[model samples]
Target chain A: MRALLIRDLRLAMRAGGGFGLGLAFFLIVVVLVPFAVGPDTSALAVIAPGILWLGALLSCLLSLDRILALDWEDGSLDLLATSPLPLEAVMGVKAVVHWLTTGVPLVLAAPVLGILLNLPSQGIIWIMLSLGLGTPALSIIGVFGAALTVGFKRGGLLLSLLVMPLYVPTLIFGAEVARRGSQGMAVETPFVMLAGITAGSLALMPIACAAVVRVNLR
Target chain B: MKQETMDTLLSVHELSVARGGLSILCDVSFDLFPGQALVLRGRNGIGKTTLLRCLAGLQPVLNGTIDVGADAIAYASHADGIKSMLSVAENLRFWAQVFGTTDIETALVAFDLVALRDRMAGTLSAGQKRRLSLARLVVSGRPIWALDEPTVSLDQASCLLFAQAVQTHLDAAGAAIIATHIDLGVNGQVLQLDPYAATSNTGVPSGFDEAFL
Candidate 1:
């Protein structure tokens, strides 16, 4: 499992691995928001939490296909299935690596980008926290979507369609937490809900993803 | 019968397999013991790959029983599973680590990949990449190898090298089921799959197109 994680990380860091692509996309989305919505500071601040969460979510979505597509194409997935490692562990490691490469960067970058949207002083940490908690769910769910569509030749659009609906609850609670935090309202409720969704996904998505991968391999 | 069952490493009884929801092979039974290699011979599109997939547990068996120990078999398919970005050595090392083994030197030497160990897999030629992939089986250390057309695009000498590797594997009491056309000169029983071909009458008609018939 450690080897798979290290290999995935190394692969992502390599050229054409799409490692920094999500972060770059996140940056572009944040930068473009000010341009698209005009320079109204208060207006931007009102929507900053939601926009940042959406950007992070979409950026995480963009790379979901990479989780298993390459391995499936080269037949490594089949070999991995037959290896000593359980399919569930393989799926879990993939989600963790995806989170490490894509989710963590987005979380770290959210705070810096939050400044561009005139984010409230208190909202910065909350937005970062929300993203940090929420993006793992995105990665885990994205892996499940990736596995479902790995058998398709052109699965990117299909993957987005399948994963976006699953992201709804996470997005709602995550954005709610950030919005409430920026507004200085009580955030514990939405924050707990967001963490619950993340925890639930972490516990269940790997098994579902592994089963989907097994079917796809078949 | 009792002694044979104890010695059997892999046993398939009345096995039937399908491809794209259509049964292709039926009633295929075989028993593989330690240190045995079973070569599956058939024409193209004859379900050789499908049967191998079934044996490797990559596909569901339509109807059958496959008796083998869990995690006891390693499967290699036509797709080499090589990551072009990684060096040959890195590729082998990754799989070795995956299969919980560490002796890559032996695999490298076995497949003559030591000279190109540091070279990226992408830089290797077709034959070289195939060698690296075959070397993966060596590092796998599993007792059983389920290989699907393992020796394609190889020159005679490389084929000989692969044969020698299989010989060494069998010498160490490992078993292999290889589907190939050419002779690798390995002393193993050949199981021709032509006789087990699923006839149209035996398989249930599937799909809307078949409904009209």
Candidate 2:
């Protein structure tokens, strides 16, 4: 599993397609928001949390296909299934690596993107906090979507259709935490809910994903 | 000694294979012992690949049973499990690590990938990639190999290299089952899959969804 993580990270760095594209796209979306909404600082501040959450969500979506498709296409998936490592653990590692490359960067970049939207100085940390708490859920959910469409050549549309509905709770609770915290309101409930969803998905999705991958390989 | 030798490395009894709830091969049985290889010969779409997958534990058997000793098996199929961006050495190293062994130099020489070890996998020719894929079996350290059309795009030289690699593995008390259209150019028993094909099989296909309900 450690080797799987190292190899995947190395591939992401050397391949150059997955590591920074989502970050760049996140930057573009955050930059473009000011233009679309005009230059009102207060307006930007009020919408900043929502816009940041949306950008992070879409950016996470951009790299969703990266986790499993390449391995499946190259036959690494078959080798992995047959390896000493169980398929569930393999899916778990893939999700963790995906989170490292995609989710962690999005969290680090969120505060900067938050500033670009004229977000209040106080709100920046909350956006970072919510994104950090929420992005793992995105990756776990993304792995399931990838498993469902592992066999399809063009799985993007179908993947979106399958996983988008599941993203609702995370998005709602994540946006609420950042939005409420930015306004100096009580964020305790939503923050806990967001963490709960991530914890639950982390515990369960790999098993579900492993079953799906096994079925797809069949 | 003869009685002990008859225990077999692998045994399949009246096994049936399926895909997506449809029966593909029925009542197929075979046995493989150490230092032996079984070549599965048949035309396209004859469930040869499926049978190899079943033996490797990648897919479930539809009926009957397969018995393999505690020694783990390695599977090589599905294109070249090669990552084009990583160097040839990195690719082998990854599999070696996954298989819990660090012995890569032998695999590198076995398939002639030692010279290309530093080169990016993307730059290698089709035959070279095939060589790299076959080389993974060596680094894997598994006792049994279930290979599906492993020599797909290899040149004669690479084919001989692969045959030698398999020979070395067998000589070390390993066993293998190969599904291929071309001759492995090695000594092994032949298990013809045509006899077990499902199209000629009748009696409502005999399991779970026997008749589409």
Candidate 3:
């Protein structure tokens, strides 16, 4: 698993369009929301959770296609598939790598991005914590979606369409928790619910990804 | 040659597979014995690769079963199965780690690719890429090796080198199921599938004959 993680990091680093591009994209999203909403701190503060959640979600989507497509094209995926390492373990490793590349970084950057959008100071913590817990589920579920669509030529668009719907519940609860916390409302219940979505997706997504990969291989 | 009994390494019974609402292969069955090699031959569009995939558990047998015995096996295809972004050595190292091996230098030397080890797999020429992929199988240390068109992009020298590797593996009582157009330089049973046999009601022509001797 460590080998797989190190290998993925090396590939992403060498691939040249990595952390910089993701950070730049996140910056654009953060900057653009203020333009779309005018310089109204009232409006931005109210919608801050939605804006942050949506920005992180879109950034997560941007990297999803690479999760398997690169490996599939170069034949590394097939070699990994045939190895004694079970597909579930491979999926687990892949999800962890995806999280490391996209999710954790986005969480660390969310506060700055959130503040830029004139978010409430109290809500900044909620945005960071919710995303920290929530983005992992997105990566895991996105992996399964990516596997299903890896074979199609125009799979990236299709992958987004398919996975976005599956992500709604997580998004809803995640944004809701952040929204409540920003308003100084009760946050534990919604936060727990968001964590449930993450935990449930974590348990289910790898198996689903493995099953989808088997179908795609066939 | 004296008749010597060998333990069955792989057993496939009445295997079938379907795709796009049509059966691609049906009732396909074969046994692989220790130290024995099997050549799967058929024209393009036939189910040769499909059978290999089924045996490797890459594709599901729509019906029936495949029981792979205790021996470890490796499957290589025309895909070369190496990550193009990674250097050849990195690719081999990843596989070695996954297969629980620490030594891959010998495998690299055997395939004559030690010099190209640092080159990105995508940058290697066709023959070099094929050799790198084969080198993986060499270091894998599995007793059963299944290859699909392993010689597709290989040059003459590398082709001969691959044959030697297979010869050595077979000499050590390993088994192989190879799908190829060219010969693998080993005396083995040939199971041929007539591309048209499934369309017509005619019995499949078993391609094994005296020349296989």
Best by TM-score: 1
lDDT of 3 by residue, B1-213 (tens): 122235777777777654433456667778888878899888886777777776677765556777775436798866877777799999889888878887889888889988888998879998898899899987788989998888997878888999888888888889889998998677789978663224433332245222211
lDDT leader: 1
> For residues A36-63, what per-residue lDDT tens digits would candidate 1 score against the true structure?
9999999999999999999999899988
Model 3 interface RMSD, one decimal:
7.5
In model 1, the runs with Cα more than 4 Å from the true position are B1-4, B201-213
| lDDT tens digits, residue span B53-123, model 1 | 88888877778789888788888899999999999999999999998899999999999988999998998
- In terms of lDDT, the poorest run of 10 residues in model 3 chain B is B204-213
Clashing pairs in 2: none
State which candidate has the highest DockQ: 2
**Regions more than 4 Å wrong, model 3:** A16-20, B1-6, B14-21, B24-29, B62-64, B199-213
Q: List the residue pairs that clash in candidate 1.
A: none
Instruction: Tell me the fnat of candidate 2.
Output: 0.83
Off by over 4 Å in 2: B1-6, B199-213
Question: What share of the reference contacts is kept in model 3?
Answer: 0.63
lDDT for model 2 comes to 0.87
Show the lowest summed lDDT stretch of 10 residues, model 1 chain A. A209-218
What is the C-alpha lDDT profile of model 3 across A98-135, one tens digit per residue? 88888888899988888888888898899889999999
**Model 3 residue A91 CA deviation in Å:** 1.3
lDDT of 2 by residue, A1-218 (tens): 99998988888887554798778889999999999989999999999999988888888788888789998898889888888888999999888988898889989998888888888888888999999999999999999999998978889889988999999899999999999999999999999999999999999999999988987887
- Model 2 quality (TM-score): 0.95
